[model samples]
Target: MIDKSDVETNVVVITGAAGLIGKAFVRAVAQTGAIVIAADIDLSAAEVVANDLQDLGKVETAYLDITCPKSVDILIADLMDKHGRIDAVVNNAYPRNANYGRKLEEVTYADFSENMNLHLGGCFLIAQKFCAAFKAQGFGNVVNMSSIYGVIAPRFEVYDGTAMTMPVEYAAIKSAVLHLTKYFAQYFKGTGIRVNAISPGGIFADQPKSFLDAYGSRCAGKGMLDPQDIANTLVFLLSDQSRYITGQNLIVDDGYAL
Candidate 1:
C-alpha cells in the first residue's frame, strides 16, 4: 500500500491514458492518491480508465487530440482552472503504429509526417504549454515517451527464413523526441520544471503475434517488458523521488537493447 499523503493532491495529466502503458500509469499514480486527468483521443477509452480509477483518486476524462493546437490549449486551460496547477504531465500518446516493421523505402511520406507530428510536434506543443503553467506555479514534471530505437538501431532478424526490418520513421520520430526532452529540460533550467523522457524497448500487450514473434527473435527470444516496468519509472520521475533529475532519457528495456 502506498502512502497517499506522500503524493496526495498532486494533479497529473496523462495523454493516451487509455492505452496499455497509459492505463498502467493511471493505476500507479492513482494508488498514491494523485488526481489524474485522463486525456486521450479516444474519449470512450479515456472514460473507462477514468471510471476504473475514480475510487482511488479524483479522475476527470477529457477528449484530447494532441495533434490539434486548439484542442490541446482548451484542455490545458480547463485543467488549470480546475486544478490551479498541473504537477506533472505524462506524454504517452502516440499517433500511429510505428512498429509495422516496414523498410525505409516502403514507408510513405504520410506515415513519416503523421508519426513525426504526434511524437515530435505533440511533445513540443505540450511541453511549451505545460512549461508556461509550471513557470507560473514554480514546479512541474514532464515525462516524454521514447523508444529504445531512439537510442540505437533496430536489429535485423530472420523469421520463417525471411529477414524483417524496422520502419525508419519510427526510429526517426522517437529519436527526435529524445532530443526534444533534452531541449525542454535545458530551456527550463532553474524554472523548477523538470523535463525528461522514458525510452522503453518493447511492450507486448495487445500487439500482433507476428510482430511480437519477429521482435522477440531479434531480442534473443525474450518476452516484452511489462507495462509496470515503464509505469514505475514514470511514477518516480513524477514524484519527488526524481526531483534532481532532468534532461535524461531513462531506458526500461529489460536488456533487450543489449
Candidate 2:
C-alpha cells in the first residue's frame, strides 16, 4: 500500500494562491506535508498567504502571471531548479479584464474575447507548460478549477434581486475547461500524467441575503460552499489515492447542479 503521507514530500504548485479558493488549496496542500508554491500575479499577497501557512508546513510564494508564457516558463524553471520535481499543479488562476461581469446584453465582443483569452487562455498555457514538464519527469498530476455553471446553465432566478448575473464568458471558459481536461488526459494517455477538473458550486462570499436564500433553495444542503469544501476535493485528486482516475471532471457543487 502506498503511504499517503508520502504526499507530504511532494512539491505542489497552485496558481492564484492568494485568492479565496486558491488560499484554501494552498492551506490544504501544505497541511498534507507537501511543499506548496502559493503562486499569484500579486507577489505580496501570495507571500502573505504563504506566511500564514508556514507553521502548517512548507509554503513558498511566487509571482505567476498565468496569461504570460514567459512568466509561466520562468516559474516552472525556478521551481524545477529549487524543488527537483513537481508532483502536481493546480490550474486555479482566475484572470479577467476590467470590463468583465457585465450583463449579457451589456457585454461587448472585445470584453468577452479579452476575458476568454485571459482566463481560458491562461488555463491552457498553464496546463500545456506543466504537462510538458510532467512528461519529461515521467509522472505528474493536474487539477483545474472549473465551476458548476459550466456543468449546467446559469440559474438566473437566483440573481433576481442581486446585482450579479453570470458572465457569459465565464460559462464559455469553464465549459471549455471541462473539455480541455479530457483533451489533455487523452493526449497523454500512455504517459504517466493525469488531468482532471473540479467544478465547484457558488462559494459563500457574503452575498445579499435575498440572493443567498434564492440560491439555497436550489441546493439540497449548504447551497453556497466554503473554500475548504472545494479544496478537500482537490487534495484527493492530487493524492495517489486517485492514481487511476484521469480525464474526468469531478463536480463538487453539492447537488446544486441537479
Q: What local distance difference test score does each model get?
A: 0.83, 0.93
- What is candidate 2's lDDT per residue for 1-258, written digit by digit as tens? 334585888999999999999999999889898999999999999999988888999999999999999999999999999989999999999999999999999999999999999999999999999999999999999998899988999989899978999999999999999999999999999799999999999999999999999989888988999999998888889888888999999998778999
Tell me the tens digit of each residue's lDDT in model 1 across 1-258: 344675677999999899989999988888778888889999999999988878887788899888788998899899888878889999888777554556777777787777777667877888888888888889988999999989987765522344455668778878989999999999999999999999998887666667677667656456587788788888788777678999999988867787
TM-score (all chains, Cα) for each model? 0.89, 0.98
Give the least accurate 10-residue stretch of model 2, judged by summed lDDT.
Answer: 1-10
Candidate 1 lDDT score at position 80: 86
Off by over 4 Å in 2: 1-6
Candidate 1, pairs of clashing residues: none
Pairs in steric clash, model 2: 8-33
Deviating ranges (above 4 Å) for candidate 1: 1-4, 97-101, 158-165, 206-222
